[model samples]
Target: MITIAVDAMGGDYGPQITISGALKCLEMVPDLRLILVGDQEQILPLIPHNLSSFVEVVHTDQWVAMDDKPSKALRGLPNSSMKLAAQCVAEGKADALVSAGNTGALMAISRHVLQTLPGIDRPAIMARLPVREGATYMLDLGANVDCQAEHLYQFAVMGTAFAAANGHVVQPKVALLNVGVESIKGNQQVRLASHQIAQCDALNFIGFVEGNELFSGKADVIVCDGFVGNVALKASESVMRLAVDKIQKRLSVWWLKWLGLFLKPILKGLARELDPTYLNGALLVGLNGIVVKSHGASDEQGFSNAIMQAYREVSNKSNDHFEAIMDQIEF
Candidate 1:
């Protein structure tokens, strides 16, 4: 059975949303067990009696706030739910850790507790973005802002490993996110990283991918520094929201409302494809243990998706695969 440790007191809604999400995950994943770390008083009432056996509650009243500084939260909050959840994975009590807490704090505490794998200098945040065929995985999302060429190369290796582990793609196509496709287009770091990634025969380096091509299904894995990646991701999400809002406003018209009824099915499918809930989990790859970070503002359903993601990673034995891939490389 796969066991996941959850920070049940983290995120915007606290235990109310997290505990409910944990229950939802249990319903979907039959062989999964959960360790909900949070205040017992708040978490207990949310859990049902029948599902009690499948979950273990680890009580803690403390939790890292969404705005907490990474360093402060790491040095203090010794018993915070996020820290304890990470510890559960590091100590082998759980197969993975899932949290919808402060991203910086989660990374800080997770790195401190679990450390990075042998070949990894620092862990990168990898998450899936909607693509025409399916979804493409991208990395270094808000982790290491000022990254070296070697860091980007490491992100490529880790991102490729992650995409392959999903069982959907074989020898996933990798591309460095750049201003343009030309070799002379990108800055020094990207150019160097591209050359480094090309040296690995195991990686399918397909040249550079620009911002507009993110959802074009041209590349299976896109690697960039955290600053660029984070900005691109947020901008894309904003664009999606803007388009949705405009469509909704247009559909509110008397004539367009009638047309909306006819297009309801198609729109629902489109919504599913673009929904952030479906793409809620982001894995902190290159860490010694699995750690899935859910968006802090995500709802119950979104949090459930994050838990399921962690379960999938555990079942896939992603860390082992990643380590093996790294072992084949000289640097």
Candidate 2:
């Protein structure tokens, strides 16, 4: 059985959304067991009747807040739901962790509890980026603000391995994100990382790729420092919001409203692909355990999607492949 430890009081809505999402996950994942870590009094009432076999509640009086500092969370809150969730993974009592809590605190506590995999200095926040064919995986979204060339190279290997293992892509194309595709373009770190990654025979390391090609399916994995990757991700999210709002206003017209009756089906599918809920899980790879971070403000449906993602990784046992790939990295 695949057991997932969930921080039941981590998100903006706390027990209301997290507990609901965990139950939703159980509905879809039959072979799954969830350890909901939070206040027993709070979580017990939220759990549905006659599901004692599937869901186990681990009581914790402390909870991590969104505004809590990473250092403080790690040093102070020993029995917080988030801390217990990570501890579950560390103790091998859970196959993975699902949390919609403070990202910094989660990372900090996860690192302190689970520790990074051998030869790994830090964990990158990697997530699927929707693209032409299906989706591409990008790393260091907001984990490390500044990364060395070697760090970028490590992201490439890990991202490549993750795509191959999880996305089922053999010889996944990996690229370094740059302003231009030219070898000489980009900062010193990008150039150095590109050269090192290209030398790895195990990876299908293509040369530099421009930002415009991020969602063009030009590469299965794109590697960059956290600052650049985070900025790009936020900017794209903003653009998506702007476009969606404008389209909604435009379609609110009388004639357009009539047209929507016929276009609803087609529009719904498009909307699903573009919606943040469809791609809600951001993985913290390179740790010894599986840790998926859901968007803090995600609704039950979105948070449940994140849980499903954890189920997939846990079922696949992707960590073995990821660690093997990390071992292959020279630096």
Candidate 3:
């Protein structure tokens, strides 16, 4: 069975939603085992007796709050739910960890406990984005705001490994997000990172990609500093929401309402594809162990998706593949 430790008190709704999500995930993956780490008083009451066989609870009264500083959590809250969850993975009690907690604290605690993989300078947050062809993965979503060319190159390597591990992609095209597609368009950092990626035969660098082409499916892996990636992600999600709202309003008209019946299937598919909740989990790549971070405001469905993402990584033996790829690259 694939075992995962979850921070049962880490999200906006704490055990109310985390427990629900864990139970929902149990229904989806039969061979999965979950260890819920949080206060017994809160987490135990939420779990149903029928599903108790597949879940184990590790009681802890403390948990990092949404506004807690990273440093404080790293040093002060050693027994917090988030920290204990990471410890489960680090100590080999569980194969992975899933949390929808404070992003900064999660990063700090995971890095300190699990540490970075061999040859990796730092860890990065990689999230999936829906594209025209299928889905594309981007890294450094909000981990490191400033990065060097080497760091970008490492992100590309990690991204390439991630795409290939999905078992569908072959030699995924890697690109640097820039102002324009032209080589001379971006700042010195982008140009230098592009050059570095081009030299690595292991990666399939496809030159620079503009913001407009983010969802155009031109590249399977997009690498940028955390600042750019985070902004682009939030902006793209807003645009998707706006588009869906406009379509709903347009269909509310008397004439369009009649036609909406025939277009119901198509609209349903579009809404599913556009919903950010469907792609909520963000993997903290380059770490020695698997740690998937769900959005803090995620509901039951979103948190369940995060758990499943961690399961997939473990089943695919993704960390072994990532280490192999990293070993092949120098600097």
Candidate 4:
């Protein structure tokens, strides 16, 4: 059985949505067990009696707010639901952890509690995005805002490993997010990182990829600094929402209203496909165990998907496989 530690009180909807999502996951996956970390009073009542057998609640009095600084929050509120969830994984009580709290706090707590994998300098948050062709994985979403060339190389290595384990492709094409495709078009850091990545024998280095080419499906893994990656992620989400909203508005005319009603389901399907939350959660790569970071605004469906993602990581032993690949790479 795969055990996932979930932050029951972490998201906007609190334990209600989180518990609902976990219950949904229980229905979807038979072997899944959840260790729900939060106040028992708040979480227990929300969980159904039938699900009581599948879920074990770990009580905590405190909760981490969305705006709290990760470092200070983790230090001050050591018993926060987010921290305890991570601690569960660190203590071997759980196979993986899923949380929809402050992104920085999740990353910090995971690093402080779980530490990095051997040979990894920093752990990166990698998210999978649905593009025109298919899903593409982007790394360092908000883990390391500023990174060294070696860090970028490590992100590429880890991202590729994740893509492989997720069955994207063996030796997935890895690219650095830059201003242009040319090797000489990026900043000094990217240029240096590009050189280092090209020298990595274990990776399928595909050279630099610009933001425009990200959805083009030319590469399987795209790596960037946290600042750029976060901006890209947020921008993509905003644009998708705007486009969808505009389409719905334009189709609201009397004549087009029927068409709009007919297309609503199709559009919703597309939106769900593109939504980052539906894609499970971002993996905090380089950790000893898998740790997935979900959006703070995520609903139960999103949380459920994240739990499924944790199950996949544990069952596949992605961390061990990643370590093996990193060891073989000639850095």
lDDT values, one for every candidate: 0.87, 0.86, 0.87, 0.85
Q: Can you write out model 4's per-residue Cα lDDT over 173-265, one digit (the tens) per residue?
A: 999999998767988888999999898788899999889977788889999999999888888777877888999999988999999999888
TM-score between model 3 and native: 0.93
Q: State the lDDT of candidate 3 residue by residue for 24-119, as single tens digits.
A: 989998999999999999888888899999999999988999999999998998799999999999999999999999989999999999998776
* Candidates ranked, most accurate by lDDT first: 3, 1, 2, 4
Q: Could you give candidate 2's per-residue lDDT for residues 216-325 as a string of tens digits?
A: 98899999998998888877776766766667677888878876566666655555555433356799998999999988887898789889999988888798877776
lDDT over C-alpha atoms for residue 250 of model 3: 82
Clashing pairs in 4: none
Give per-residue lDDT, candidate 3, residue 321: 76
Candidate number with greatest TM-score:
4
Off by over 4 Å in 2: 261-272, 275-278
Give the Cα error of residue 83 in candidate 3, in Å: 0.8
Superposed model 3: Cα runs more than 4 Å off: 258-272, 275-280
Identify the superior model by lDDT, candidate 2 or candidate 3: 3
